[model samples]
Target chain A: MSLETPLHRVEGLGSSHSGVSHFWRERVSGAALIPLGIWFAVSILGLAGGHYVSVLTFFSRPLNGILMAAFVVISLYHLVLGLQMVIDDYVHSPGGKVVLMLAARAFALACGALSLYALLEIARVF
Target chain B: MADNPQRPGHRPRPLSPHLMHYRPTPTMISSITHRITGVGLGLGMAVLAWWLFAAARGPEPFALFLSLAITPLGQVILFGFAWALSYHLLAGIRHLVWDLGYGFDPRSANRWSLVIFTLSFLAPAGLFVLAYTGNGGYYL
Candidate 1:
């Protein structure tokens, strides 16, 4: 029933689109989260009732500091992507949707930066 | 603009067959809860950011943070978050498996959902038991 040639039909259907990258990044970040989340849960449970010094000492470890930073950055990025999808699906007004999306990105970035700064201080970066 | 038999002065408004249109099933409930929990966890991150800010501020502020964390209301919030975290973690894993094109059949999907629902509670309960037994000194 179609009249188009194979080459014509194939035009513009390629990997140049943004959707593929977004899909992969989301999945990759999710895969990264499993182990990182486990580590974080156990570590936080261990530090739950500790004083500042005790918590600081645990984070002061080189590997712990690095992994904590990675967790904050990656998780925040993933969070923003997930939130953006929800907003796009639910928000009908174009102007309101854009504003909400931008606000989400801003909030995630701010939180990620603050978390990194705090981790650095804990690890005595200064 | 013209009157119709069904409505003398107006036309029937277009209505979406929304939530009520579909019969509720386990998978439906699980999917909806997934979105709700995602939003809840996002809000919980704000509390976490506050904790980190206080911790970085030094011992006095951190102590103040702990004081607030242990209040009756604080404990409620903490335990709520723990439950949320457990449920979200299990649900997330279920989603990841689905992403790989597995568990689409109704029987397996329902079974997995039931398993997730049970384990969500058990995970947090186990943690509490450990803390109470003095094995999880972190909770003290």
Candidate 2:
């Protein structure tokens, strides 16, 4: 009997922590990744055919290690956020949506952890 | 909705345009590609972590990584990642620009999308060349 539109009924419902903070985070993380990602890509190209020692040397450098770790963390953060949006779009079931969302978060966290760990271990000589 | 009793035959309301309903444009394609690449790069993150894992494990494992990377399939994956990253970066920057309230015109939007697509392929190809052949054969 309610005249309220569906959007009116659901507005600020269903995981509304606040206004578009999820969106804002995506943009901020994405913006940061532009520089970090570019640096990582070009550096990898520099090492492209390089010997094992050269890679090891690359890892050993303080700046390279720091930047690689930063890039990995931010990239994964951006990725999971993007995945969340995609899942929200296509997944209709509430349970399925939550499952997919959790899976995305787990995937990103694992990847980031391993990346950071590897960066640390590879640069152990420093 | 199909279940709504107010409808005589219980038919669903006509939905908005689905994929097949409308003519596709550069803007549309670019948008879908951006999302696809975004997910694709999620998978790429695993590869990135795997690479760092290999690198951290020392020379033997690192050599294994290099060997695999030099394979044809591995090259394809690497090149795909390169292109994906490039496209996503450009598209992401475009989003940022749009957020700032620029480039909303259809002509400029379409043009930027084409430019993004073009650079995505070109940058990766160029980088791949520079990496494999440009600097005296691959790596050190």
Best by DockQ: 2
Q: Ten consecutive residues with minimal summed lDDT in candidate 2 chain A?
A: A10-19
Q: Which stretches of candidate 1 lie over 4 Å from their true place?
A: A1-17, B1-16, B138-140
Q: What DockQ number belongs to candidate 2?
A: 0.53
Q: Give the per-residue Cα lDDT of candidate 1 at A34.
A: 74
**Candidate 2 C-alpha lDDT tens digits along A1-126:** 977678856675444645578989999999999899898788888788757777777877898888888888888888888988899889888999999999999999999989888888877753
Write one digit per residue (lDDT tens) for candidate 1, span B3-97: 33455587785565667789988888888877777777777777777777777878888888899988989877877777777777788888889
Tens-place lDDT digits, model 2, residues B1-140: 23444567776666666777889999999999999999999999898888888878877877887888899999999999999999999999999999999999999999999999999999999998777676623334
What C-alpha lDDT, on a 0 to 100 scale, does residue B140 get in candidate 1?
Answer: 28
Per-candidate TM vs. native?
0.86, 0.88
Give the Cα-based TM-score of candidate 1 against the true structure. 0.86
Strongest candidate by lDDT: 2
